[model samples]
Target: MGSSRQCFQRFLEQKNIVTNLLGKLEENTGVYYLPTGSIAFLAFCLIFGYGASLLCNLIGFIYPAYASIKAIESPNKDDDTIWLTYWVVYSIFGLAEFFSDIFLFWFPFYYAGKCAFLLWCMLPVACNGSQILYHCPIHPIFLRQQASMDSLVTDLSGQALDTAASLTREATKAGMTHLQKNK
Candidate 1:
């Protein structure tokens, strides 16, 4: 708890883009101060029964996608690698979630927990979840399965091409038959 608070404080202290944007909005809105309405809205989303899933999904998708585009545009390869790692981790999580969401959504605070997790995974810190996950279990597992995965993918691609060719031939034959009958 203490470390998390410290990390959040440090994040705020940095006055990064998110904070600066929020601060600017608060200044212009003039309804509430920094973090107050933000915290309230967050808490409301977590506790309320509405829009939580949308919020969580948006958080998981939008920022990382924007960052990925930025990474692609920039000259540095480091951010590119980082964004790629993030996408890898996110894809894995999405696959796991697909099977588990039926049960997972039963929990009251599931969306909130997921939002926090996505934030953790998206954090710019060295110890972020995406980096840790990509380095450890994910990398090891991929290394072990890469050969089999490659073989499977190659087989599937060949089969797909074969099926596509067969379909095209059948369609052309039908078209020729129809044209002859029409004449």
Candidate 2:
């Protein structure tokens, strides 16, 4: 963990081709700013200003989607588990957000908090938000409700099939009546 943190710090500190290009552009533009200023500005917008929702959603969605795709391709079972856990956590978050979004949008720093939460849930660490929430809260509730949920799903499936069959029969009768009239 310590080594990984050190590696991350080193990565942040290193300046390469992209940094050099941005530096030259800043110099020519007669502006003095750190290479990371753009990121800071973006973060500021996400936290306090307009377009925060869009930015927060992009942060929540794009990276995990890309990571999930890569996880599908990878041979490692652990990465697959990680991505699956992320999706489960994300799904629950989405479900809760769906019901609360109208009111939540009016709250101060909501997008910022959501964005931070999304980032936490997607973090690569072992004890990331997704894993913690799943293990501590979600898994137990799922266990308790699994049987009831299965029964409800079964009932719904049967009803759906019955409805589809009735619809098909009605459509067939209509088609037959039209064909008979033409004949």
Candidate 3:
């Protein structure tokens, strides 16, 4: 009976220590607004309520659709180029997310996890994953391929110009010759 009482007291002390440690960590981490345990549950319910979910869905669908239409209609070359690069990266990320969802969707916090990841991607702060991806992988690979395609296009255009010039000269000579003979 004495040993049992000692063990229970030790357990309570350990629980208090852990709770205090977590509270300190949260305070230091600057996430004062972030809820934990029961508060977290309530916050989740409020944030992901039906109306909020519907609004998120609507924005998700509308933004991309609107962007696509605007991209098609816009005449600015530089903006179009920027949008093209963004869409390329976005498409690649979307494909990766599609495959990952097969497993991750089963998790209870999947939507929250996804929202956090996307926020990380969009945030302009240092060490953002999207910025890293754009600079390290997508930018380099896309630029190399684009450079090669640009060179190929330039060569083709040069060849076509030469051919057209040659044809025009030949036609002019033939016309002059015909006129001389008629005279």
**Compared with the true structure, what per-residue lDDT tens digits does model 3 show for residues 1-183?**
999568544543454333456557678886644324534654375356544334433433454455556767988675455445445556686788778868865676556555555445533245555567788998888788997889999999999999999999999999999999999
Screening candidate 2 with a backbone cut-off below 3 angstroms (N, C-alpha, C), the clashing residue pairs are: none
Show model 3 residue runs off by greater than 4 Å: 1-58, 116-132, 141-183
Candidates 1 and 3, the one with greater TM-score? 1
Ranked candidates (TM-score, high to low) = 1, 2, 3
Candidate 2 achieves a global lDDT of 0.85
Candidate 3 C-alpha error for residue 3, in Å: 56
TM-score between candidate 2 and the true structure: 0.82
lDDT of 2 by residue, 51-77 (tens): 998898887888788778888998888
Per-model TM-score versus the true fold = 0.88, 0.82, 0.37
Question: What is the alpha-carbon lDDT of model 3 when measured against the actual structure?
Answer: 0.60
Q: After superposition, how far is residue 183 of candidate 3 from its true place, in Å?
A: 64
> What TM-score would candidate 3 get against the native?
0.37
* Segments of candidate 2 deviating more than 4 angstroms: 1-35
Q: Mind sharing the TM-score for model 1?
A: 0.88
Top model by TM-score, which number?
1
